[model samples]
Target: MAAPDDSEDQDALYVLTAALLTPARFPAALGDDYPESCAALGLDPYPGGYGLVIGQDSDGARWTVVVDDVSLVAVAIASWDCGMEYDLSPGERTVVSVLPGWPLDLAVAAPGLPAPHDPAPEPEPSRDGSGQDGPTAGTALRLPLAPPDTGTWGPPQRRLGADEIALHWTQWRDRTEAEDAEATGTAKRSEVAKEPEVTQDSEATGTAQGADAPGESSENGSPSPGEISHPGIRRVLGELRAYLHSDTAPPLGRVRSGFAPDGARMLRADGPGWSFVARTDDMAFVLLDEEPGEVLPVGRGSELPPLLKALDAMAVRPA
Candidate 1:
């Protein structure tokens, strides 16, 4: 077996995180001997002090378990453009943790992680359209037990429930709307500054002509389907939606999501072409014609902590 690269680790982490966070029940195989177990799963344990165990569940979700002699330290899951992690403690016989944007009803538990520290509550939109903090408590389950063999790993078998699908769609819609508002405001300001002063007669005639012009065709008046409503949120929502519905999840090494200080959602994708921050109702827009590998500036100082927080929570890199 060969040592895993960052991408491999990311993929495995995403699978593990999803399994741990969701309500699905899949086979979890465990082994006391790290190298032996990894070998069974076609992996080699890392040379670092931590014992690395990799495996796949029946649903095709890849899992990476990091352990020390005394306890399981962490687990990760990856599929497509998403990855997640959960830190564990040996002392806790049972642990419960919540994924930030997910509903409390979907919280899942594992055996190894210690009790999670209470994070400050984030206000989320309720069904009534009022802001309410989601409950912290989630459903509980045991950590993956050792499977009989390594070849048992396969893709997820179950489709997401309506509630699960709704959660994702709502989040995407809210983020997109926020991004669009900011972009619209900026565009309006730019247009105002560039508009030439017209004579009263010309202004009157122009208004009348515009009124008679059959209100521009929908195709020309509205944004095209390919155009993102907000450049700041960029492709984060699109990428996430695709990942959720994909039969095979891809390795998403750079995309991450979280909440802002004012309790608004935020997402960021740091790709080779462009890196941007999309906060609820605000964004750092990029030109459509921007070249690949172009390093665009994002938020700074106090404005950046939330994005960093989201990235860190997603475990884009090692915590």
Candidate 2:
């Protein structure tokens, strides 16, 4: 495959889709020597042939294996966003080690390379409602997956559960509110926002908004002011935001529901992106994404770690 080209715009990063299976259960349609065949292309053998499949748009930017799934269907997805901070560079490799017992999390370990700085601050609103962070239109796009070809699998049409959709919508609402507060210079996002233990600030706000925030609609039951500001398909934006925050380092243990992971590192520098590992029956995943509308479309088969985490988290809960 072609390496990423840094000189190009970040959007140039291509999402290549590969449907791979173990040698033992190799798809007869593909081939018997699929593993060896892929190995010829510099593809490393993931313990289960599950590795990343996406890459940057720069030269020498080979795709680094970051995520894998071994049980039902083993798959890996490598990804990179060219020309940006908090994104994988041409040669730096970021891996998502999801072995059987190991913490199925994501991590980026660069020995001597300079850590990239956060992208220039974007204009936001202040806490006071008078500021600009109110309602604006942002695009809503979906990052395609590999196996279930949308074209063949039919146009992107997976229905999220009501609870799942509600949770994400609530997350986006909170994210929008936090951004609005920041934009208007009204308040700051608490450092402990990621922690499950309720923060004094969040509690205060939650109480003040009482019944108006979680599970409650805006006055007249219309879109809240925050929701109106960040327009476009609501569900897609929520999914993208959550997927980009998967954990990659140690402490990879699954997340403790009702409580945040202690010392769980902030993988993304953006104000609210955070991640933790959670598991579903027979499967485990890392939940990523802390901010809404912050994810970019990587290639097909390559999705945000947070999304995998969400799926795994969903699987683990009792049906």
Candidate 3:
């Protein structure tokens, strides 16, 4: 279909504005100069088919008036925050205008197609018990992760054996115990009374010998197999199970376990398109992917559900 003429679009914008905005609430003039005013405020004017005007009241509060020529049925007047990108609130306003400072971050639909933000009736509840505002099931949420390089990722390997998993659990437990002991020692030292003492030559020699004495042994004794009941570890495992069972679950491979230099147990999922890792002591999950390579930290318990949903949406089939 041929595009509407510029004049026709502008007229529609005016009509939309009149229908939605009351004169008392959004008293602002509109004309060709609307775009120019946006430029004066250090913002880019809405490209063709839209105009904008800023209105300030006696109290110094500001309002942004926006008219979209194309929609013809909707316009928006919203309270303005100088630091924020301008957008309309629901019901009271239906159209959005892009003004300068930042480039317009519009999500344009296909030509002649309605965009996701198109004015519509109130959204209905989703089947998954989440309302329309919540994420849809089966959609992958893009996480912040470093972009994947050109090199090919290797084939998926077998899952970690029971012995390897046990080793990681042992490391994690030993580290936790060591930390507890150090903390207890510190508290005790702080509470002890300081005393002055007279020292003979023999006593001085003994003190020097003690100072030179070997420190405690650097050994991490293993715990029994049944002792892997750390609350944090159990929570992580539970969340992992939920992810695997979800409808949008990614094709997760075996668990790869390692230890950090500080003796923390690091567990990673071998998968395509995305990487998941968590430290036993951290009690949180980190998602990595190609989009921005940003590390997203997902908290435990309640936060895991939404995060797992997002992870499912972002997962892709392996090459």
Q: How high is each candidate's TM-score?
A: 0.24, 0.19, 0.19
lDDT for model 2, please.
Answer: 0.29
Model 3 gets an lDDT of 0.34
Better of 1 and 2 by lDDT: 1
Q: Which stretches of candidate 2 lie over 4 Å from their true place?
A: 1-47, 50-179, 184-310, 314-319
The residue-by-residue lDDT of candidate 2 on 1-319, one tens digit each, is 3433446565343333323334322222221133442333334544355433343222212232334443312212222223222332222233342111101111331222223122222333233466444454123221221222222211111111111322343354345456545644432344324434556876877654222356333322334323433333234434334434545421111122222235221111111122222211111112123332232211112123344444334221111
TM-score of candidate 2 against the unseen true structure:
0.19
Per-candidate total of colliding backbone pairs: 21, 42, 10
Write down the TM-score for model 3. 0.19
Model 1: per-residue lDDT, tens digit, 53-79? 333322233344434321243233333
113: Cα error in model 3, Å: 61
Candidate 1, superposed: residue stretches over 4 Å from native? 1-255, 270-276, 284-319
